[model samples]
Target: MSTILFHEIVFGPIHSRRLGVSLGMNLLPYDGKLCSFDCIYCECGFNKDFRTKTKLPDRENVRAALEDKLLSLRREGITPDVITFAGNGEPTMHPEFKGIIDDTIELRNRYFPDAKISVLTNGMHLNKPEVFEALQKIENPIVKLDSALDKTVRLLDRPNAPGYSVAKQVERYKRFKGDFILQTMFVRGRFEGKEIDNTTEEEISAWLELVRALNPREVMIYTIDRETPAKELEKVPVGDLQKIAARVEGLGIQTNVAG
Candidate 1:
């Protein structure tokens, strides 16, 4: 089985396909993966594979580690383009998520005022008032909307909530009021005995309606770029992604294809 990708609390001034040179903040436990979605294409592999006894890093530890990293980068004259909250799991699920976001904002202001603060989330916790407020504070609230159909979402994202539905998530996403960046991962695959593909015309048409309703500032359409826990999946090519982007752009919503 594929394993968790990041092992440290504060990791990477790595090049991100979407966020540019980013410094990552991992609020989840370093030894395990804790997430709301069990995406077939997750780079961190399957959630069940990396369950651990390690605890989630506290707000104080996250703040201190981030500050230390920022100070070190400053001393070395290295400036990152963004401070990203993405690691082994759903970052907003952190118990003190709002406080952590506040701490991150303060650190960003002190160390790299020009750097954008971004949170890459699966959009599960947006129903919570505090999560919504915290996401609003970030420069890039890149929320996921992999599929518009509830059946497709169940197959593609495999959300942890027993009663999770696409309609409810769309309503939660509307709370952003065009302030958030909409991210979609297009792929084709088979999980268990079922075939899965979200790049179909029917799927894209339904998705376009949701994009229209949400009116996001930007739409990021991309495909699988790394080894996934599910070995049967196939990546959507750049040409196809560009074609999808064109269709989305036709709706008057700016779209970027990460290929």
Candidate 2:
């Protein structure tokens, strides 16, 4: 299984294809993956494959570590573009998520006032009041909506929630009121002897309808950039991605494609 795990509360000032030079903060366990959705394209691999036997870092610890890292970066004269909430799993799953966002905002205001705070989420917990509010507090609340159809979502994201449905999630996304960034992963492959592809005409048509309905501020369309847990998966070509972007752009919504 190809997987990448961050073993610290503050992991990187790594260059993100979409978010720029980002400093990552992980609220999940440092030793293993703990996400609500077991995405085949997840860099952290499947949840069961990397089950954590560790506790989540508390709010204070996350604040402290982030501060220390920011201080270190300041001394080096390296300013990150964004402080990203993403790591081993669904960050909103952390109990102190709302409080942590508060602390992070204060810290960012103190250390890097120009920097933005972003959260990369699967949107599984958007129905939770705390999670929804916390996401709103961030500059980029990038939520994943890989496919707009129930069956495709089930096959692609494999969400842990038994009653996960695209219809319910679309309504949940509407709560953002076009304030959030809609992220979708485009890929095609076979998993567990089942063939799958979200770049198809049918998939794209359905997804475009969702985009039209939700009317997000931005749409981020991309393909697998790293080794995925599912061996048969393949990346959508940059040309194909650009074509999709054109369609999204036609909808009058800004679209960012990371091939």
Candidate 3:
């Protein structure tokens, strides 16, 4: 068994593959790990055993903590490259998500006005008026799309019910047109007894077609990098990821392999 990563409100001016050196806001909990999906490759492990009491931090508390972190950075003369909304779960799940984004954007303007703010959303609420509207204020609102087919998506994402299908997600992306970024986590694994091998030709073809249809500003391609609940899983190698990226690039879509 692996040791658990503690839940917390903020964690790192740490380097990120997608976003540079980022300061994270963990709205979840110091012990909570909730998510819209129970992905096998999640860095925080499955949300089951770590489900939080949903004792979300009040807006004022969140602002205070974020400000403290920013002020500390300023005092030390250390400036992060990005202020990110990410933690143990899907960020959009927060009840005050819009307000949080507004507050974060405002703070970004104050402390590190030069820094960019980002949200790592699952896109489950991409169609929700509230969620979509909030994302518009950010400099980079990266959304995930691990598969193009409904079944594969269901297995890979394991989203909470009431969230709709791949078609609905594509429709949501249409609203963003070419502004939104698409991030697909590639790998082979089994979840809840279902085999999730999206690296296969059939699955990749379907995914590439979706990319062509969606026409996002860019596509981020990467695989598992941390310990997950599903220990039986195997990580896809860098060369394999490059191969997949090449295929997507052939469609004339911009691709980043998280290198």
lDDT of each: 0.91, 0.93, 0.82
Off by over 4 Å in 2: none
* TM-score of structure candidate 1: 0.98
* Residue-wise C-alpha lDDT for candidate 1, range 1-259, written one tens digit per residue: 7565677889989999988999998888788889999988898878888887888989989888999999999999999999999999899999899999999999999989999999999999988889999999989999999999999988889999998998898889888889999999999989898999999999999999999999999999999988889989998889999999998899899998898
Cα error of candidate 2 at position 32, Å: 0.6
Deviation of model 3 at 106, angstroms: 1.3
Cα lDDT of model 2 by residue, 1-259, tens digit: 6679999999889999999999999999989988889998899988888886898999889989999999999999999999999999999999999999999999999999999999999898988899899899889999999998888888889999999999999999999999999999999999999999999999999999999999999999999999999999999999999999999999999999999
- For model 3 the TM-score comes to 0.93
Candidate 1 positional error at 146, Å: 0.5
lDDT of 2 at 137: 86
Q: Estimate each model's TM-score.
A: 0.98, 0.99, 0.93
All models, RMSD in angstroms: 0.9, 0.7, 1.7
Give the number of the best model, judged by lDDT. 2
- After superposition, the stretches of candidate 1 with alpha carbons farther than 4 Å from their true spots are none
| Ten-residue stretch with the least lDDT total in model 1 | 1-10
Which scores higher on lDDT, 1 or 3? 1
Clashing pairs in 2: none
Question: Rank by lDDT, descending?
Answer: 2, 1, 3
Model 3 per-residue lDDT tens digits across residues 20-139: 889988877767687888777787777787776768777788888898899999999999999888887888888888888888889889999999988888888776788899888788
